[model samples]
Target chain A: MSLLRILFVVLVAYPVVLIMLGINVRHRARLPRRGPAVIAANHNSHLDTLALLTLFPLHRIAQVRPVAAADYFLANRLIAWFSLNVIGIIPIRRKRERDGDDPLVACYAALERGEILLIFPEGSRGEPERMAQLKFGISFVAERYPRVPIVPVFMHGLGKSMPRGEWLPVPYFCDVFVGLPLKWRGDRESFMGELEQSFHKLKEKLAAPEYL
Target chain B: MTRLSLPPQVMYALLGAVALLIIASAVVLALARIRPERDYTELKLRIKTWWLIIIVFCLAIAFHRDVSLVVFAFVSFLAFKEYLSLIPTRRADHRVLFWAYLAIPVQYYWVGIEWYGMFIIFIPVFAFLYLPMKMVLIGETQGFLRAASTLHWGLMTTVFCLSHMAYLLALPDDRNPAGGGDALLFYLVFLTQINDVAQYVWGKSFGRHKATPTVSPNKTIEGLIGGVATTTLLAVALAPWLTPLTRIESVAAGVLIGMGGFIGDVTMSALKRDIGVKDSGTLLPGHGGILDRLDSLTYTAPLFFHFVYYLHY
Candidate 1:
């Protein structure tokens, strides 16, 4: 990461995660210490990436990349620069118009370099605190990197605090549950099923009363 | 700018508090060692959290008044956040929640500037009226009364009541015979927390009859009487050094804190029971959340502050 990005993480991101949001992480030890690794989490708010980024130690931030939609994150020059350098996102095209274009190319390169990738399985953020259907793109990545351990992280309350359209964040306590790593089950169907089940189990672990 | 200086009395009181914490840590450690089979993890974690809480609180008050006020304001924010996160709310109330949060800094600003007039009425008058008005703009009428009442009640408990502690710091030194505002603030907090511990300890040793068994089953009649006695005696002993209260007044203050603390604690328990959750949140390891730690303070702070403000300030 650049010096400016590190400064931003230390000053802005740390306070937002540690103080303002006050995350309670369960099974935090299950998070991968090093990569090549894949973290599949539910999509909710833009703060999801920032919250996940903070889960890693500051020294390892450079090796952690969040796979984001290019059109949304790379809409303009200034945002493109920030998305590329500051957030260190690997912008993937959500829709491939040309048959020759491979959307997973950058993701493949990131895994090859032994970097951790954070992927939100839900294609786009839907209603706040509501989980949308998981996309099958992550199954392709699992097939390519069969040996990499996929960690499932279920987070709650980030949606209520700063869901899609909301710019101002209300300080709500968030709960993060990290599940054990699962390997690709040799087929896309079984692997996706396993991933979906793992997420369900993680969500069930936080069966407390819903506030939002 | 003037250098930050705590009153000599406040410094000695802090030293005394640190010593008590050390003794508590040693005692818990010894108990864990003596009974290896029994699970003392919760006790150990509670002690460890107490150390962190006391150190952070002391640092905030000892640094500067501005810093201390900010710390108190942040505490209110955390408590309010925890309360909101635990309760059910309508989606329409989301924007109003933001406005509710915005009231914290503004309320604390009034306390910071020593504007007692504004500080006392800001939430009860302005926020109470304005928050519902903002919610009305959202055009959702279903469950409107429930949302408004819960939101306002949370502000009253978490922000308005807790702000009295910050206001203590703004109390003029000349009007306070307890050295200054820091000493008074420490006195209230120390007594409230000690009262909690005393009640627990006394209840554990000689508890038989239940006190408000429905609201809080663990609280005992013996604990209430024993805790009040201990607090009253301690208040009288520490009155001259920490407050301008007479012996009789100190007794009244102690009884008020002991009973008020019990009511506050059980009230939170009732809320948790109604919500079908154990703790408010998992912020602290063994203590649940900020609301858990400050439950007693929510009652004691306002009661003690007004008692002193009326008597001396």
Candidate 2:
């Protein structure tokens, strides 16, 4: 990360994640210290990326990049710059219009450099605290990097704090559960099934009441 | 470095608190050693969390007046946020919730400036009317009454009642001979918490009859009476050093705190039971959440504040 990016994460991101909205992490020891790894989490709010980033030590922040939607994050110049540099997101096109285009190329490059890639398999934040169907794109990434450990993280209450379409965030306590890494099975179906099962198991750990 | 100045009574109270914590920690450690087969994890975690709570609270109170007010406001914000997160609300209530949160700082600002008129009425008179009006603008009448009532009740319990404790700091120094506002704030909190622990201990040791079996099964009539007696005795003993209360008024304050603490605890228990959860959130390691810890204070703070205000201020 550049000086500006580090400054932003230290001055802005850390306070927001650590203080303004406090997080209680379970099985924190399970988080991978170094990468060439994949972190798949349930998306609820924009704070998801920042929350995950703060989990890592500051020295290793540059090595952790979230896989975000290019069209949404890179829509405007100011946001695109902040998204790319400050947040350090690996923006991938959600829609592949060209027949030959590969959206996972940037992710692959990041992984080859032994960096951690954070992906939200739900593709978009659908509803607060409700899990949507997992997109198969993550399975493809798992297949290509079979040696890499795909860590599944289940988060709660970030949605209610600052869900989609809400500008201001109320201070709600958040819980994050990190699961043991899931290896890619033989094919996409089994891999997706295992990923979904991991998320379900993590979610069950919290035993959260039905969201309002 | 400038020496941190605290009133002599507050200083001794803090020291006494530290000593008590030390003893509790030693007892927990001994228990763990003696009962190796049993699970003392929760007890150990509770003691550990208490240390953190005390340290943070001491720093907040001893740092500066403005900082302490901010700390209180933040606590209210957390409790309010937790309540809103648990309760059901319509999608239309989202924007209105933001306005509800904005009420925290504004309420505390009144306390900071020592404006009693605004502090007492900001939530009950103004916010009670303004929130529903904002909801009406959203035009989602589906479950509007439930939404409005829950929101207002949460504001009352979490923000309005809790702010009374902060308002103690705003009380004129001359009126309190014992050490002014901080001393009274400490006295109220100390008594309320002791009342809670006494009730729990009394209920545990010799509790045959349930107090509120449906709401809080652990609460017993024996515990209630024992807790109140203990609090009353302690209040009378500590009143001379901590407050401007006479002997009779001290006993009244004690009974108020003890009973009010029970009501507050079970009120939160009822909320948790209604929501179908054991704890509010996992913010504190073993205590559950901010709301769980502050539940007794929600009632006792206001009740004790008013009692003292009427007598002294």
Candidate 3:
């Protein structure tokens, strides 16, 4: 809603999304019509959030909140401003998880408010070729709101485009695979396993020649 | 200098282009009606794109010189982006790529100020040396030669070659023959494009032997000759109004642009072949990408610039 953030998205973020990322948002029709839903994607680069946020329908963007790590997103005043306001990121303290604080609390509140919470369940950026173990935080939040749909998203090629440790991004084609959403059945372990399996299936489907 | 004035030749040429487009549209419409079952989607989309391109380009050149430069600057930026996106690059070369993108504006800035010295040397001298030096500091020589060559090639074709059109527009009003800079710009674009269409038509009609079978099978010796001859004749007809060249010199310039246009297109084809892409990108609906639309300009722009610059400037 901030004027500066809108300007930044239009002038800076959209161009980066189009030219640098070459983002293809596939299965857009599968995105839940409304929220109190969770959109979980594999983390590969910093661009994944921007790509997904931009891919979300513009009218419903205000209700889309991305869950970002506190240490990374809140590292500075500028980044924090961009993350908090521009991206509407719900900063969760990943490092301070054991300090009697539940990171899922903020996410749960967001879902309860009918906000679409975008969380990278891998907890951090990982290799694009493989998906890491899904953090329990995602399933935990989904169980509290069992009716909510958890959409499995697979991002292709952002890791090489603007991976961690690279100050500048190279132009690379990236595809965002939005799969059908799954509802929580209250079994955290099986839910997480199914979520991971869904990601693998999405990745395989995208990699197949017929999809291209 | 009548800075805001549009030359009579430019006005007349634009009118002619509009007339041609309308006639072409009618013909295509008739063809669609006659052959309703055949797919005319791609052809219709190409014509639609031509309408937009003609309007945008003519409007750009119709404005003040600096505004036109900005339009070309934007084109260069997109072309460069498309080229880089298709090519392989390393993480270490990201900073250098940033500099390469920055060079687009700076190169056009030279045209804005008419600084020929810096415009000519900035990319070749400063960018050429600076990219490698920056890569050396990164100290990753894994794909060093391949990376450096691709970066330089992207800069040259995307920024350096494409910027020549802006520079041609920047030529002093008095030195650019009777129709001045605007006419000259339109002349080059019009002729180069017509040359492309001519080649396609000729190739389709009478093309026999493949020019470069492996590199570009569609190009043929017959097409090349027919295209050059057609362009040369058109050049002589439009010479007095569009360019400073005398009739004979216009014929020579026509040959240069015609051949250069073919070479540039096939060069891009070879690049697409090397990279194993059918099209550079899908920005333009039927044209595949900006690179696909402007490939001939990559060669024709610089060749025409130097030819004019040598004769007049």
Candidate 4:
């Protein structure tokens, strides 16, 4: 097992699993229990990290790596070890700054390995309800690995569960909805355009009164 | 002058929390009763969130007076968060932006530890090097120039600028416990807000010529001069009660805050013009989001902090 996968189970995924059940976890989309899939989420809170994990039985999976920023989580040796190896996070350098080449390469490597990669299409995390401009990185990777199914994931009630800077996660019962896996038809631009629309469609699905 | 020998902080933030919450909640309730709530849920949520933050700040200060500085740091973090969320940022610069985000807490940490020498320039000089280096490393030949500049601008506007006020509490003074930081906070905040109100009222009531028509149409020279004069006179009278500054020094402080505040407002107005928004957020009942409340402080905090640091620290 990759060090990143172990860290994910022990540190991130465990707490999420415990909390999801604690909050009476339910899946409206009713995703399959097992699969090699790529889950993309809305960008908004730091807690959005664990919020997505609440939907997956992460421990059962052997190869899953969530893409995180190299600057924040892996800026130092200790945090890097925890984020990159233990938590099963692939540190990709954000192309915006002058320093993100290594992480982008790592992301490509993880996809080639057939890992259950978590891609944040909107890039920076925070507002799961709104879809802003998304980086084509998810599409870029998917274009290379056509077999990997890209799943549109959205979490309701996360904005209140843990806002920015509040260390303690509030006892708000948030729900997660994973849409059907979106299969790419091989054209990179068309796939990305469709994926962006899929993200909004899932958000609209979660935003309905039934999910609340 | 008598100085009280208490802990590092008196930790009266709980008192402040209660006062602010009642005030904020009352405003929200009154607004909801008078206006349609459904049309403005977004505004209500923002205020509620601000109220929650204030409550958390109070609890943190009351519990750990020694680390009450964290509360101010947290405020800066929120203000920065709100500011960045509205501003457009590209993915190519995410690595350095992360550094910029982390810089919020670290900048406030320096204020908590009272490290002025580096805290003063952490964003401008060091962050300048760090942001460029991060961008350079990405090796993306295109958009580096624009992205790098925006990243630098965000850090300067948000963290470096906002952290100055929190640093004021660390001012080396012989007057009171907490080094009169609370007084400095009240004094500056009160002055900035009053100046804003006074300018708006004066502009609305009187005057002919616009201050800058393009940058800020609501601003008028008559309003600026009248507000500054009125705010300066008020500071002269209020200084002895709220801050340790002398009456003359208080007048100077008032003038500084008044003028600095106008500049900050116009600067934000310019950005808003670019982004095309009338208010930063519809959070406060009559007020806007954290950005609206903080816009003046972005310019005033650093200007005022540096003033006291030179004359009073």
| Candidate 1 colliding pairs | none
Clashes of each: 0, 0, 0, 29
Better of 1 and 4 by TM-score: 1
Displacement of residue B209 (Cα, Å) in model 3 is 2.4
Share of the reference A-B contacts seen in candidate 3: 0.15
Task: Write candidate 1's Cα lDDT for B1-313 as tens digits.
Answer: 2335788898899899989999999988898889888897766766776787788778668777888888888889888988887888766777899999999999999998999999999999999999999989888888889899989999999999999989888999877666788888888988988899889889988999999888888999999999988988898889889888889999999999898898889988898888777666543232257788889988999999999999887
Worst 10 residues of 1 chain A by lDDT: A203-212
Which tens-of-lDDT digit does each residue in A39-139 have in candidate 2? 99999999898889889988888888999999999999999999998889999999997998989999999999999999999999988999999998999
Report the TM-score of chain B alone for all candidates.
0.96, 0.95, 0.94, 0.78
Model 1 misplaced stretches (Cα beyond 4 Å): B1-5, B281-288
Model 2: which residue pairs collide? none
Task: Give the CA lDDT, 0 to 100, for residue A189 in model 3.
Answer: 87
Sort all candidates by DockQ, best to worst.
1, 2, 3, 4
Off by over 4 Å in 2: A209-212, B1-5, B35-46, B281-288
Instruction: Please list the residue runs of candidate 3 whose C-alpha ends up more than 4 Å from where it truly belongs after superposition.
Output: A1-12, A15-22, A74-82, A95-102, A126-133, A142-147, A156-161, A166-175, A182-212, B1-3, B282-288
Tell me the chain A TM-score of model 2: 0.97
Question: Which numbered prediction scores highest in TM-score against the true structure?
Answer: 1
lDDT (10s digit) by residue, model 2, range B1-313: 2227677998899899889989989998998899899887766766775677677668657878898888898789878877876777666777898899899999999999999989989999999999999999989887889899999999999999999988998899889978888899889988987898889778878899999999998899999999999999999999999999999999999999999999999999999898887777543332257788889999999999999998888
lDDT of 1 by residue, A54-140 (tens): 899988888889999999999999999988999899999999979988899999999999999999999888988888888999999
Docking level for model 1: medium
